[model samples]
Target: MVDVSAITYDALRVAAEHVLAKVREGEELGTEDIFILYLGTIVNELRDVRSEVARLEDKIDKTSQRIDETNKRIDELAKSLSARIDDTNKRMDETAKSLSARIDETNKRIDETNRRIDEVVKSLSARVDDLAKRIDALQTTLLEIQKLLIELVRSRQ
Candidate 1:
């Protein structure tokens, strides 16, 4: 009878192999040998389960590593995009400042042009007034000469 107590997996495997060899030699297998064979089958199935579990763990580790790498790439892209946006904003601000300065310069030129136009208008108006006064004086002198000529002609008649 095989000692069931304190039987390690290696001892059980050796006993099972011995029993298989005896059975192949046409020797009758006792009940204890059959039981050892059954236990060996259970141990082998457990080993296969452990191997499958390890394989799955390795695959999961690889997937996790890939996920971490992808996250890092996303972070880098975000940083690059943020920097580009900041640069664009800075350029826009500079352009706005330049345009404001140009607008101010244009307004100053417009103000100067208006002042010159006003001066020219005033000068022309003063000259027109002086000419009108001279024309009135000439009309009055002509009327007085006409009256003196009529008086002289009447005295001679």
Candidate 2:
């Protein structure tokens, strides 16, 4: 790499020395030499400014690359999150379906149990009614037998 600072420093030092030497000799500097010397300092300052600008541009480029990398990572994270959400949704749907099927089966079992209970109740009711009718007929027969016994006792006396 070219060392612009070193070159500019050397040029400035040489011009200053030459001017000092001419002044010590009691000689007047030519107008062209003074102009050239003055312009040399200006050119060196411009070179330094250009070097600073290049360094700043390089920093900007690096910063931009870092930002792009960050964006890429963010995009990847978003996609990963989206995929996870979709998977969770699918699992929830499956669970709901399973729960619904189980609920349907439980309802069917409950309905069957209710039907059996009704049938049992109807059979017990019929048995109770039959027992009541048989008891009533037995009571009437006993009353008729008691009347016959009383008539026999009165004739004997």
Candidate 3:
């Protein structure tokens, strides 16, 4: 009976040791599950960051294209403005030439009018001198006639 009890006690101790090992293995599996969960969360965050970076890069590319288009438009506008300025300068030069020609023509007409006026004044002066000479001759003739008439009358009386 004593040997049988010793054998039984040994068997019971072995069984308790096996159950404790199983419990330890279950704890290790729970820790491994928690670790896997943390790893999955980290991977998900990295993927989100990569997607955001790609979006930002696309926006930057679009902005660069818009800037290039704006530069091209500005260059075209500058060229147009330069051409308009050149045309305006040409018109101004033409106007100045026309005005100068007209002024020259007006000056020539004024000179001709002054010359004609001078000739008319000279002709009027000459006519006035001739009339004065004729009046003097007529007066002398009248005095001679009156003297002849008086002599004839005296002789008749």
In candidate 3, what are the lDDT values of residues 59-91, reduced to their tens digit? 999999999999999999999999999999999
In model 2, where do residues sit more than 4 Å from their true spots?
A: 1-43, 139-157
Instruction: Spell out the clash pairs found in candidate 3.
Output: none
**Model 1 misses residue 73 by how many Å?**
2.4
As for candidate 1, its clashing pairs are: none
lDDT: the better of candidates 1 and 3: 1
Pick out the ten consecutive residues of candidate 1 with the lowest summed lDDT: 2-11
TM-score of each: 0.63, 0.63, 0.51
Model 1 over residues 64-96: C-alpha lDDT tens digits? 999999999999999999999999999999999
Which wins on TM-score, candidate 1 or candidate 3?
Answer: 1
Q: For candidate 2, what is the lDDT?
A: 0.89
Residue 82 of candidate 3: its Cα lDDT? 96
Model 2 clashing residue pairs (backbone):
none
For all candidates in order, the CA lDDT equals 0.91, 0.89, 0.77
RMSD of each: 5.6, 6.0, 18.1
